[model samples]
Target: MKNFIHDDFLLETDHAKELYHDYAKNQPIIDYHSHLSPKELAGNRVFENMTQLWIDGDHYKWRAMRALGIPEKYITGEAPDSEKFNKWAETVPYALRNPLYHWTHLELNRYFGIGDLLTPKTAGKIYEECNAKLGLEDYSARGLIHRMNVEVVCTTDNPLDSLDHHRDLAESGWPVKVLPTFRPDGLITIEGAAFIDYLSSLSKITNIKIIDFETLGQAIKKRVEYFHKNGCRLSDHGLPHAYAMDFTEAEINNILSERLQGGTISKKEVAQYKSAVLGLLGGLYTEKNWTMQLHLGPIRNTNEVILSKVGFNAGVDSIGDFQQAEQLAGLLNGLNNKGHLPKTVLYNSNPNDNELFATMAGNFNGDGIKGKVQFGAAWWFLDQMDGITNQLNALSNMGLLSCSVGMLTDSRSFLSFPRHEYYRRILCNLLGKDIKAGLLPNDMEWIGKIVRDITYNNAKDFFQFPSYVEKAPLENG
Candidate 1:
């Protein structure tokens, strides 16, 4: 019997197979957005076992194991690494039709040369086989990145972070451009538990006491320059919804003063304050030519009972039914009117907002930048096959899909790079089926270039990494 994953895996037609093999298969990856660890890459850390490499810090697996009624000890508690791997293998058979099933096999085949489907029956041998090779020099953190032909990896970073690891990697000359993305969600979120302390660290780092709104912008401006000097060209935000409520600068200042004084703030006041801060940051981003990524619509920690055990970011978040279009259009329009709108990518966690986001992106594209406001890759819960297809279809129907910046892992795992391949296959299949249906022309040369461009070129130019990108040596190939 043939392996479940093969050259023709998701490709459904001859044209699809040719397009993937000829154009998209081997393009170098530009992971412009991800949650990967800069410290691991800097140190070239080696995995001691399969669980550490796959299960630890992966809430996807944790959620799956919990669904299988596996105890918390096996999922995230004090279970041994070997036992964790065993629990994950047992849950694999139950994960059918889930993205995790495909991702598990893809990572296994790409990284460890294991092709058998993961299940309880095959768990022990596969685990031992993977653990044996993970300690090899070629399986180190940097090695995994290079092995996947990654050209640039931009990691999400907090504003208060020193980015010393990025500096170390750049000077270490490791070839993969390990860069940082400015993520100031904490800075904008005034109601967060750690808001005051986070600002204190920001003030200390920039040496500008953030006593109020003006000083806060100044300190943030200094950090933007700091990041730009360190080769950062991207910024990211994670919010429940767009904050575009109208408010005067004085109101914002008063709100900041209220928060600083341990006074209460109303929900409307919070919205106004965040809107004011977002507008302020937009100008800062445009000044530095940064791409601001807004990842909206996640009602986090919905499972308070699960939260008690997982602390946070343990995969308990779900899609929020927040009002998106009006607030989002307001935010983008406010930025555009002020001439402070930088290149921006809009990501919506709720699938219902796909077309809304696609059409909204077109409203700001006349500023001489191609695909200025992007409908970013399907995100979080929506990164699977159906989500990817629907997102692409919406962009193709309402916006220019050809100039797309294309797929990103948006993942924290090193082995998740094959998701790019997963996306490419689905993309090619879409075009191929269209061609076979006579909906598109039989011009492989033209369509193939589109495939190649979407897979790699657009991202390289979109982020403009020419300034800091360092290519890995051919010997590493």
Candidate 2:
């Protein structure tokens, strides 16, 4: 028996399904912030098999395996790919209510037309079939993007990246827009073990002698400018908590000097330095009109023993309970009162802070910029059905859902593109249920357009992709 309802498959009569088919089906994806390698994308690399396609770079699977009681030897270990797939197969049956189960089957169905539910019994068959198709031309990276309707993808990149692949894509003049996002996490964390070494690297990257705080600021500015010239319009940061400390210029400089001279700086000093740098970075974002994203409240790498063995993003990070609202308020209000706040999106990992996240978004959105301060959609661990629905409800209740930019993958696997569709299906279903209950009128045209905009067009416009008009050379008579 094929698991159709178990599939929760969208129906034709369902308003949400109609909306998805009518509006979002043919549109292109504009992934604003992802960790996908631009090099592989430009080269149009192919995957070896389903396991390699889905699990090779995905930390989500690693996390799920850990949750399923799989040993690390099989999770991130050197076990054969077949053994890993078998282990994952055993876990799939137990993952009944999990979004991964749905995502796994959906990818199989959409990509390979395989309708069989994935379980230990059916795993070998599905694996063999999918791996056979892996050799097809349509299975290549760019082909996968084309099949998924992805038009513009901006990969998160460090300050040290030369963006050679980005240049290649631009020169190729493909319809797909592959841009780079300036991620300065390496530069921003001034208390890490490699802080001074990273500073020297930044100096070399920008060819500026970063001897003082001002010099470091200048060096960062230079790199940002370079990134902008190469078609970057977004900046990303990962912070444990939003920095809101007050600091004097002398105070910040003294801390930087201490770190430079091999002196051990205390935790308080780290906070002040981070706060001061974040303020300056916020000011730059304001001046440049760039969209800035903060991934806040991640108690990163909670399993320190595993961290020491396997390193970051190996399924060890967890959400933290931090003073997010007040801290975010201070940082945002500082820029808001000055009329210099840029377009901002806040992503919180802690589900308990959903209201705090939603309300904080409202506080900084006073400039009549529709959807300016957005509470990011279910991110990381929250990218599931319950998570997405809850986030939508929160946004709809506290702010304007119609103005929201629907979903962003924030993912690593090409197979994870189905997540966008999953989000859209859930969104439409919510609206459909409302209409069916007479809460809203079932106007297909308007609702369809809204659906389209949310799933595809909103992200397109939000990220500022080059359009037909923009592509034409400017008149210079």
Candidate 3:
């Protein structure tokens, strides 16, 4: 039979084919947000087999396997790597309408050149072929990134991290710009069980005494300066909702003291502490011209049993139905009023808030920045095709789609770069359909420029990462 993932797999019409092949296909990826390990990139680690390369650290596949009634031993337990691959192969055919089905075949075709369907019958042969490729130098971590034509990758990092790996990668002179993004979720989450421990770690990292909120802010500022000097120009936070409650510095100090002293604080105090810390960080981000990304509305660790076994990020998170609009507006407005609202990207996991987020972004889109406040790409559980289309449509209808920054991997696996290709095809197909239906004018040249901008230029301009300036220019399509 024919190849399953041909050049025109997702490109349905001639217009779609032209857009994908001519405009979107060859654009260099600027993966500004991902969970990839900086150590792996720095070390250039090679994998032993398909399971180690593909299935490990991929919670998407784990969730699917669990849904298929597969046991934990086969999924994440001490089963042999080959057996895990067999279980994943068996689960693939059942994921027909899921994004995993498309992602699986696309990754297979792109990486391993395997065109046959992944089922029980073809599992053994495909496994061997991929394992053999994994043993090659070109399939190493750094090599895989280079082969995908990635110009830049910004890995998420905690404030307490030493960033030795990032320094190593930068000094080694890898062609791909591997940088760090400041993620201060641990510092801001005062109510979490690990709050005190995180504070102690931060104290150790910064060598600052954590007696009050002032000292805490100083510690965070010190780390931000360190990160900035080390080529970081972005910060990210994952919160259930924006915290904008008003509180004085003294009140915040009191709250921090209570929490540090093992005193139980109320929810109101938690909000006050969070608001104080986030607001302070927002000012720092603005001062340094950093792009701040807010990922809101994820209800994490819902299943205690599964969470106990697997800890966090093992696919037990779901969308939250929290009250977002008022607090989000308050937070942004407070920063804007102070002229400290840096370029921000807002992402919501709840699909019902698509229009809410799009319009909210529009409310703060001035100051000569094209898309200063952006509706971030469909995130978390909403990264599927339907969810992506909904987010795109909402942004197009409510905001300026041309100025919107494009897709990112947001994944922990190196093989997830194909997700960017998947997103680009879907994008081109949408615009092509619009042109054919006369919803948008038939102007390929103008449309193509827009396509290229969203695919690469927007992010490159939006995030003025220090490494981008230090490195050579990216190749043109």
Clashes of 1: 0
> Lowest-scoring 10 consecutive residues by lDDT in candidate 3?
468-477
Per-residue CA lDDT of model 3 for 454-477, tens digit only, reads 999999998987744333212110
Ranking by lDDT: 3, 1, 2
Backbone clashes (count) for model 3: 0
- Residue 356, candidate 2: Cα error in Å is 1.5
Question: What RMSD does model 1 have?
Answer: 3.7
Best-fitting candidate, scored by lDDT? 3
Q: Summarize candidate 2's per-residue lDDT along 169-206 as a digit string, tens digits.
A: 77776777888888888877887888889988888777
- Select the stronger candidate by lDDT from 1 and 3: 3
Looking at candidate 3, what is the lDDT of residue 462?
A: 89
Q: Is candidate 1 or candidate 2 better by TM-score?
A: 1
Clashes of each: 0, 0, 0
**Candidates' lDDT values, in order?**
0.89, 0.79, 0.90
Please, what are the lDDT tens digits per residue for candidate 1 over residues 1-477? 889988899999998998999989999999999999999988889989989889998988888888889999998889999999999999999999899999999999999888899988999999999888988888999898899999899999988777778888988878889888999989988987788888888877778988889999999988887787778899999998888999988898899998988888999999999999899999999998899999999999988888998788887988999999899999999999999999999998999999999999999886778888999999989899999999999999999999899999998898999999999999999999999999999999999999999999998888886466343221201
Better of 2 and 3 by lDDT: 3
